[model samples]
Target chain A: MSSLEELAQRVAEGDLEAFGGIYESLLDPLYRYFYWNLSSREEAEDLTEEAFLRCLLHIGRFDARKASFRSWAFRIAHNLLVDHIRRGKGLRKEELDANREADEPPLGETVEEEAEKRALRQALEELPSSQRQVLVMKYFSGMSNAEVARALGKSEGAVNALRHRALRKLGTILESRGWR
Target chain B: MSGRKSKEIKAALAEDLLRRVESPKAPQRLQVYGLQRILARAAYETRTVERRWFRNPALWRRAVVLPLTALLLLAAGTSGVYAASMDAPPGSALYGCKIFFERARVALTVSRSSDARLEMEFCERRLRELQGLPESGEYRAWERWSREYRRNLEGVDSLLDALPAEESAGLAARFQAQLEEHHALMEGLLKITPAPYLPYLQQASRECMERLQRLRHRHGMEEEERGQPRGPREEEGTTPVGDTGSEVQDGAEESGPCFPSPSYPQAELEDLAPYGEDTAPSGMAWTSDAEDNWGSSPKESNGVMGEGSGHEGKGSANHYWK
Candidate 1:
C-alpha cells in the first residue's frame, strides 16, 4: 500500500502516533499554502488551524482511489479558505493593503534592488483567485503544471494559459511601475 | 546595453525579485495547539457516533448483524412494516409505540429539544404500554434491552471520562454531559419499558389469532421472527416521527419561543419576503454580479486585476530563460 493509504488506515484505526507522523509531514506545507494565499502571518495561522480542524471532522470520507491523501487534504484546506473568505472572517481589508505596501521597494538603494520583488508580490495579490491559485501552486509550492491542474481540477491547458496570462499581467504591472 | 544584454539583465532582476518573496511560518505553539485540538475534536466525533449507535437499539442490531442480513431484510419487504405501523390511528397503542420509537431515534440523532420533545409524549405513553406486557417474553426482552441500555450509558460515561476531570461544572461542558446522560436513559427505558410487549404476548397467547397471519405476513412480525420481544418497530420508509405533519406544525410554532428564530423582528422578515430571499444578512457579499462581469471581460481594469499580472516583468523573463 502507498504511504498515504497506510497513514489513512492508521488514522481510521485511531492510532494517534501515526496521525502525529502525518501531522508532522504535512503541517509545514499546509501552513505555507495558507500563508501564501492569505499573505498575513496571524490570519494564516488561524486559517491553517481551521483547515486541520475540518480535516479531522471529515477524514473518514476520504477515498484513496479518487485522489492522494495530500491532494484531498489540500483540497479541503482550499475549500475552507474559500469559505473563510466568504464568511469575511480572515485577514481584514486593511491588513491586505498594509501587506501590499510593505512589499514595495524601500526609498533608496534597497528600494531599487528589491523593486522587482515588491512589484511581483503586489501584482500577485491583485490577480483573481483562480489565477492566484494557479500561480501559487506552480511557482510557490514548486508543483509541476500537471500536479497543479490536478489539484485545482482544471485542464492542464487551462492551467498553462492561466500561468501564461498571469505572467504577462505581472510583467505589465512591473513595466508600469518602471521595474523593468 | 545590447538587446540581448538588456534581456539578460531583466531576467536576472526577475529571478532576484522572485527569490526575495518569503514564506510565512505559523507560531510553534499554534501548530502544536491546533494539532491537539484536532485530535480532541476527532475523539469527540467518534464518541458521538458511538453514542448514537448504542442509543438506537435498531441501529445497534443492524451494526451487530452481518451486512448481508441487513440487505436481505431490506429486500425482503419488511421495510414497509415500520411505515405502515406508524400510520396507525393517532393515540392508538401502535401509534403511541411508533412515536416512542421515533423519539428514541431523534433523541439519538438530533440535538434540538423542541424537535426532541414533539414525539416525547408519545414515547412516554408507549413506555406506559410496555409495562403491561405478559411475563413470558419479559426476560428475553429485558436482556436484549439491558445490553444496549448499558452500552449507550457506558458510551456516555466514556465520553465524560475522556474529558479532563477538572471541568466538571462549566455550563457548556456540563450541558453536553447532561444531554448525553438524558438521552442514554431515555433510550434505555424505551428498550425495556415492557408495555409494548403486550401486543407481542397477545399475539403469542392467542394461538388461534392466526398461524395464517404469522405465515402469510411473517415479514411483518420481525420482532417475533428474531424471537426478540415485541415492541414498536419503526415503520419502514415512514417519515421519521420527528417529521410528522403535526410535529412540523408544532415545530413551526415552538420554533418562535424555544430558540431565537432566524426570523427575529417579524416586520423585517416580511419586508424582505418580496425579495424572494431570507432577509437576514448571512454576511457574504453577493458576488454573482462581479463574477459574471469578470468572466466575460478579460480586460485589465487597473493595477493587476487581470489573470496574469506582473509575471512578464523580470520574473517571467528569468523563468523563461531558466
Candidate 2:
C-alpha cells in the first residue's frame, strides 16, 4: 500500500498520531490549491485547516477501494472551494488569475520564465473545472497520470488527453498574449 | 515553436507553476493549533464511538468487541463517568465532557439543518445547567454557567442566521416555544430566588427570548424574500424589518400552548433551594418533568422529543431539535 493509504488506515483505526504524518504530507498542495483560487494567504490557511478538520472527523467512513487518501482529501478541498465560492466568498473569474502573475517573481527564474509561468497559471484557471482538476492533481499535488485518473474516476488515456489539451490551450493563450 | 521545443517549454512551465503554488509557507502557529484542535476532537470522538458500540448489541457483528470481562470492566469504569458527566454542572469534574460532546456533535453533523438543531439544543442544555447551578448555592458555578449560557445563545443566533429558510423556520418556532416555557418557569422562580441572583437569571432568560424572536423575524423575512408565505405563527401586521429586535409577547401571539402546569410539586422544588431557609434552589424550578417535553414537535402526540418520531434520521425540517 502507498504511504497515504497506510496512514489513512491507521487513522481510521483510531491512531491519532498518524494524522500528523498525513497533515504534513498533504498541507502544502492543499494550501496551494486554496491559495490559487482565493488569492489570499490567510483565507487559504483557514480553509486548509478546515479541510483537515473535516478529514479527521469523517476519516472513519473512508473506503480505500473507492479512491486513494490523497484524492479523498483533495475532493474535500475541492468541495470546500466550491462551497466557499458559492457563498460569494470567491473573487470573480477575471480577478482570480489576473493578479497571481503580478506578484513578485520566483527567486531564480528570469523575467521571461516568470511571465510564462504566470500565463500558464492563468490558462489553467480559465479551463473547465474538469480539465483544471486533472492538471492540478497531476502537477500540483504530484499525482501520476494513473493516480490522477483514479482520483478523477477517469481512464489513463482520458487523463493524457486532458493534459495534452490543457498544454495546447496554455500555449495558444501564451501566443495570443505575445509570449514565445 | 517546434514540437520538441514546445514539449520542453511545457514541461518547464509546469514545473514553474507548481513551484509558484507551493512557495507561500503557512506559519507554524496556525499549523500547530489546527492539529491540536483536531487531535483533541479525535480523542473525544473515538471515546464516544467506543462507548456507543458497547451499548449497541446489534453492532456486535461489525464492531471490535472486547472480551466479556474487559468489556464489563471498561463499561463499569467509563459509562459511570460518562453518565454522571452528562448531568454534571459547570464546576464539576466531568463537565468537560459536556462541552466536548457539544463540540463533537457540531463537528460530526454533516447536514446544515441538523447542525442548526444541535446548536439550538446545546443552548437549551446550557440554560438548563444555568438554572441548576444556583441550586447548589455555589455563586461561582452560577457565574460560570451564566457565561456559558450567553456564549451558547450567541452560537444559536449565528446558527440561525446561517441556516436556510425552511430549517430556520422550524428551529425558530421550536426555540420560541421553549423560550416561552422557560420564561414562565423563571417568572415562578423569580418570586423565591435570592435577591442577588435574580437579575442575572432574569436577564439571561430575557436575552435568550429576544434573540429567538429576532431569529424568527429574520427567518420570516427570508421566506418572504423567497416568495414563500410567512409561517402560521407570525402576527399579520408586524413585518420583520431588518434588525428591529422586536419583542415577542407570550399570549396568543405564539402558535402553541404557552405554559403548561408544572409537572413536579412546588414543595419538591422548594426543598432544593440554595439560599432561603424555606425555599428551594432556582435550578429545581426549571427541571420539572414538563420541561422535558419542550423539545417534542407540536404534531407528535407521543411527546417523545424527536426519537423514532419518523423525523429522527431523515433530514426533515420538522425534526424540532435533533
Query: TM-score of every model?
Result: 0.41, 0.39
Q: What is the C-alpha RMSD of each candidate to the true structure, in Å?
A: 38.2, 28.0
| Model 1 DockQ class | incorrect
* Alpha-carbon deviation at B178 in model 2, angstroms: 58
Task: Give the least accurate 10-residue stretch of model 1 chain B, judged by summed lDDT.
Answer: B279-288
- Candidate 1 regions with alpha-carbon error over 4 angstroms: A90-92, A98-119, B1-16, B48-322
Docking class of 2: incorrect
CA displacement after TM-score superposition, residue B262 of candidate 2 (Å): 63
* Local accuracy of candidate 1 as per-residue lDDT tens digits, A23-131: 7666776787776677566677777777776666676787878877777777777787888778876546577768756643334545544554445666667778888
Model 1: lDDT equals 0.49
Kindly give the stretch of ten consecutive residues in candidate 1 chain A with the minimal lDDT sum. Answer: A103-112
Deviating ranges (above 4 Å) for candidate 2: A91-117, B1-31, B40-322
Query: How well docked is model 1, in DockQ terms?
Result: 0.16
